[model samples]
Target: MNWIEIAGHTGALLSSITFIPQVYKVWKTKSVGDLSLYMMLIVFTSTLVWLAYGVALNLWPVILANGFICFLSILLLYFKFAFSRKVIVVAKVKESE
Candidate 1:
């Protein structure tokens, strides 16, 4: 492959791998207290748009990278909701006491 293809693949790999730490932290802690749900939602939506654009253009790199990002973003959204509900329950219990 040419240098351009190598660079594109490298960039895609790096971006996708960067989500690993966040995923691990959330999974290990079972918490997403500090993460911004709004931001993630926006990003997830943007990634979906990018994936669609990639599909239209038939760009494999864009499609692959955004696809992986969409997956990770969904996980993050799940954790965000789960943790937020936990926090609310805790708060309500404390208030009741």
Candidate 2:
């Protein structure tokens, strides 16, 4: 592949993994306190738009990268809600005790 394509792929790989560590950390700790829902929603929306743009332009790098990023972002967002609710439930139980 040409250097340009190589760079694109490299960037795609980097972009795709950005959320991985955060996902793992949150999953392991069951903590979403530091994650911002607004930022996540904005990023998730932007990823969707970028994915659509990439598909329309037939750009493989953008398509593949944004698709994976979309998945990661959604997973993180899910964890945010799930873990936050879990914390609230546990707090309620403790309060009642």
Candidate 3:
């Protein structure tokens, strides 16, 4: 493959794995309180568009990257509603000078 094609594939791989950490963290903590619902919705929508564009252009990289991202976004969205929001309150004690 050419350099440009290789770069595209590399980028695709990176993009596909980008959300794994966040997903894992949320799954482990069971916290979606800090995550924005709107952001996930926008990402899911945008990935859908990218997937359509990629399909139209027959670009495997775009298709794979956006497809994986789309799935991740959906998972996040589900987590947002399915998981309870956990708020941790920290109380600061005054120290004597």
Local distance difference test scores for all models: 0.88, 0.91, 0.85
Taking all chains together, each candidate's TM-score versus the true structure is: 0.85, 0.88, 0.78
Per-residue lDDT of candidate 1, residues 10-94 (tens digit): 9889987777789789989988878888988987998999999999999998898889999999988988898779988998999
Candidate 3 similarity to native, TM-score: 0.78
Winner by TM-score between candidate 3 and candidate 1: 1
The TM-score leader among the candidates is 2
Ranking by TM-score: 2, 1, 3
lDDT for residue 42 in candidate 1, whole number 0-100: 88
The candidate maximizing lDDT is: 2
lDDT of candidate 1 vs native?
Answer: 0.88
lDDT over C-alpha atoms for residue 58 of model 2: 100
For candidate 2, write residues 1-97 as lDDT tens digits: 9999899778879988999999999999998998899988987999999989999999987888888889989999999999999988989999999
lDDT by residue for model 3 over 1-97, one digit each (tens)? Answer: 8999999778779879988999999888888989899999999999999999999999987888899999999889888887852232212222322
Q: Which residue pairs does candidate 2 place in steric collision?
A: none
What's the lDDT for residue 30 in model 1?
Answer: 87
For model 3, what is the error of residue 92's alpha carbon versus the real structure, in angstroms, after optimal superposition? 29
